[model samples]
Target: MRLSRPLRALVVVDGTDLHHDLLGASSALRDIVLEGGVVADRAVGADRFVDPLPVTAEADVYVLYRSSTHLAPEQQAALSAAVAAGKGLVVLHSSNLFGFEEGGIDADQVAYELVGSRYVSHGDAGSEGTYTVRVRGGHPVTAHMADFVIEDEYYVIECRDDVTVLADRTTPEGGTQPIVYVREHGEGRVVYVALGHDMRAWGSPHFRQVVRQAVLWAGGVGLDAVASWSTRFPLGNGRFIGPDGGAPA
Candidate 1:
């Protein structure tokens, strides 16, 4: 369905110490939202660390892609409250590594609960390899998605059973692991994607499709709405173009 107005998304990508290309990932995320016909505003580094509470209130959906900076308890509570109050949340990749601490002290349990999963491990050292993302039928986010291959960290996560699994991958140990899922929090929606390790995943058309659909779905856009809009205006090449038909700033 075509929205009467564009949804506002606040994309946050910051970490004290990160091994992944967070800045590049953040740019890709912003582009995905924009191409999906949503308005995106990014918060990076120190800008995100300052007064995180107020920022949550301004956007309809919050997209997070951070690896290592810990949020304060109150900050975590604010995020949980925001989602509970009907704001959407899209968590990507290493953002699941939120609550763990070396000695289990000062863990951000609220954030972990909000995400509905925690990163357990990626298996072994050379585990980062090519794998297929198998789409499970019957979800708006994976409506017309096809299984695609990507080279990334095979994330092993401990997830809540309540979340609906939309897509998954097979582990080397002959097991299945969820690569994408969704859940509801109060009046809001939450989506978690285990891909996007780097450009390898980001460059995939299937990955872009999932992220775009996830953002729209989380923002309360129904399947029919998205299908209608996408049919009329396909996101060609997944590039962000301004209203004037030129590249955006």
Candidate 2:
């Protein structure tokens, strides 16, 4: 199945300020193929990744690099414009910086609310400790993730009145943190992953899977979605054992 028009994806790894190799993110994303099929668009999404609007309309996928700048005008404009163009966008950590600065909440609202919480701040290494990422079920993006540990900046994402929270991690207070989330912006769809401070995180298979799914989902791909590694999903252990109470493999 082909994507409807106005759903091409462009992945922008805007690390121009952080001083890291954009090549890895560029290359890894370049390797992703939709539904096991290669395309002229997604393959070259990296090269097409630009700083601002040379990019037409919204891409089915837009991976913006997170930096220290607090929601600069150009950044916000590009993002808003992408949605106006009717596309799907995925923002990594620090990308949230642009939305919020060192201030209180606002009427405009930037912190994404997917489920019912907010992604406020990062977790402290000493008190907040790192841990593994356990998959709740058979989500294509998360199932492949081995419970890995990383002491990254956790968040307090305010659950918007609208949206869905995909994954949640626990915090020092034993409260659940909204890690991955999705919502609609205009006619377009937007998803945010509250991690990826650097390239290493950017390259995780699980991370990549979330991104791929967000791309397809934003492009109007249905619940029966299929990515390269997601032939099996919605993995509920929905089965009865044999005569005896045994596991079903």
Candidate 3:
């Protein structure tokens, strides 16, 4: 359904001494969401880990890119409660790297369950290379998207059986690996994208398109409304201009 007002998004990019470029990733994501006519705000570093805002109070949707080693129990609970109350969640990249044994954290069960998957490994030699991403048809997140190739660190994760895989890649061993997927938790909707390792993946127009649509879908915007918005503000070469012919507000 069309939203009566602009969708508010809380983009969290928090981590300590992380290998991934959190700042760059968050910047790219913010631009993508804003281009889709949504208002985006960021929570970075200590602000997110030490003192976090109430998840439900901050925005209608939560975009997470946390590569940290741990998430506090209270914070995890808050996020769980928010999503259960119908707030949307969009998890990206290493945000799924959480659990007790797998995540190296004390209390991450709630967060782990929320993400619906736990990162296991990429592959031998770090599995960083160019590969094709096949977008699965018939899903809102994969609408109008075609298979594309990208240079990234392909992740291997163990997921719950209930998630619907939207896109995937073939492993060197000729096995199917999920690249994008969605889940439903309580009254909230969740979307997880396994791409976005760094600027190389984010620079891809296809990657940006998937993420933009995922954010919109999680925020409860209907396909027709999303199409209308895309028609008005087409994302060309990752740059989007407002209707007034200036930067997006």
Q: Pick the candidate with the highest lDDT.
A: 1
User: For candidate 3, lDDT tens digit of each residue in 1-249?
Assistant: 235677899788877535888888788888877777788887774244335556437688888987876677777877787788888899998888776455463467787788788788987646689999987877677775667788988799888887999999888888888999999999999999998888998877677777878888888887776554542334433333222333442
Question: In each prediction, how many residue pairs overlap at the backbone (N, C-alpha, C within less than 3 A)?
Answer: 2, 18, 0
A best-first ranking of the candidates according to their TM-score comes to 1, 3, 2
Any idea how many clashes model 1 has? 2
lDDT of 2 by residue, 76-113 (tens): 54556556467566666645543345543341243332
Which scores better on TM-score, 1 or 2?
1
Report clash pairs, candidate 3.
Answer: none
RMSD of each: 5.7, 7.0, 5.2
> For candidate 1, lDDT tens digit of each residue in 29-147?
89878867888888874244336556546789988888774666666777788789898999999887754665342376777778888888887635599988888867888765557
Q: Lowest-scoring 10 consecutive residues by lDDT in candidate 1?
A: 240-249
Clashes counted in candidate 2 amount to 18
The lDDT of each candidate is 0.77, 0.50, 0.76
Better of 1 and 3 by TM-score: 1
Lowest summed lDDT window (length 10), candidate 2: 232-241
| Model 1 CA lDDT for position 205 | 62
The TM-score between candidate 2 and the true structure equals 0.64
